[model samples]
Structures are given as structure tokens and as C-alpha cells.
Target: SIYRMNFAASLCKRVNIRELVTNVPAYAGATELSGGGLALVFRRWATKKTAGSTKNGRDSNPKNLGVKKFGGERVIPGNIIVRQRGTRFHPGNYVGIGKDHTLYALKEGNVKFE
Candidate 1:
């Protein structure tokens, strides 16, 4: 389109045919070569961009942290009673706390909470 405009501008400057081309109907399409006229059609337009990455690596994986055994549930020694990150629930009686604050059964018994 720019090339056509430059060619038309140069031809118009050299031949002095702007007066004749300006009066022609838009639907006429092209002009006679001898007339040294220009017919321009512009139809380019902006469009919406496609979707990019919807997921990211900033999100961490699930830790699966929570109570594993409920109150009144029977558990043997070494059975996990609760999985936690802090002292949310303190161990009592036959239960023991792990280094990461998890609670496990130390002997066979029913679970309890206080």
C-alpha cells in the first residue's frame, strides 16, 4: 500500500493528474494507464491476540496436611493421628509428636482430643 502511495504521489507530481483522479467514483477500481491516475483501497485492521500461558510455576504443590485420624477412631502404635506444620494439636496420653509437629499413636487405643 505504501509503495502504491509513493508511486501515485510521484506520478501525480510529474503528470499533474490529481484533478482528474479525485473526481472519479470510488467503485471505478483502477484508472487508465495514460491518465496517470491512482486508486487506493485500504482494508487492514487490528485483531484480538490469542490466549497465552494460563498456568504458572509460582503455585506450590499441595502438602496434604491435616488430621489423618478422627476422635474415637482406634489406632495402633506408629499410626499417624494428625499431620500438621505447627503445634495446632498437642500430643496426649499414648500419642507422641514428631519433629515436624505431627502426632502419632504410641500404643493401641482410641483417639481423643482435648
Candidate 2:
């Protein structure tokens, strides 16, 4: 990068000494050196803007769906046993299923899958 900057400086000096007065140490001033000629060739080497993404990328919020209580785990009444999108696990004795198909406990006891 240093070599490229030095080369560009020298090239600019060779092209026009007046242009170098403001360009050195701060190429930001290079924009002033205007001429529809070869001096403006360095502009082509300047950084190009990154291409914007064209794909319609999107993502939905996580549902946080999963088992909340495993078998043999202690549970209180109304405690969620499983959170799922469908009837993955049927509600057994002392268990109940919610409108969203989530299984919950109906009584205080150790959770059982069967």
C-alpha cells in the first residue's frame, strides 16, 4: 500500500506539479485536480463501491419451540412439558395439550413420557 501511494504521488508530480501541492499526505484533495485528460487516469484505480445485494434475503423470528420438560423431571400443574408446532407427543394421564399443541402438566408429579 505504501509503495502504491508513493508511486501515485510520483506519477501525479510528473503529470502536474501544481496538482501535487494539495494531493500529498491527503489524497482527499485529489478531487480538485480536474482535466478530462490522462491526469485523471488515477481515478479509475480508486476504490469502487461494493455492489448491493440483489437477492431478496429475509428471515423469520425464532419460534422457540422445543421440549421444556423431559421424562422423570418434576413438574407442577400447568407447567409446560413440551412446546411444539404439532402433536409430536400425545398428552398422557395428568397431561393436557394447549391450542398451539403444547403439552402441559395437569397435576403436580414427576413427568412421564408414556
Candidate topping TM-score = 2
lDDT of 2 by residue, 1-114 (tens): 999999889876655655434332334355555544434223336698899988677888999899999878999999999999989889889899999999999999998776
Where does model 2 exceed 4 Å of error?
A: 1-53
Worst 10 residues of 2 by lDDT: 19-28
Tens-digit lDDT track of model 1 for 3-90: 9999889876755556545444434445433343554444446788988986666877999899999989999999999999999999
Q: Supply candidate 2's per-residue lDDT for 3.
A: 100
Against the true structure, candidate 2 reaches a TM-score of 0.51
Model number with the top lDDT: 1
lDDT (0-100) at residue 34 of candidate 2? 56
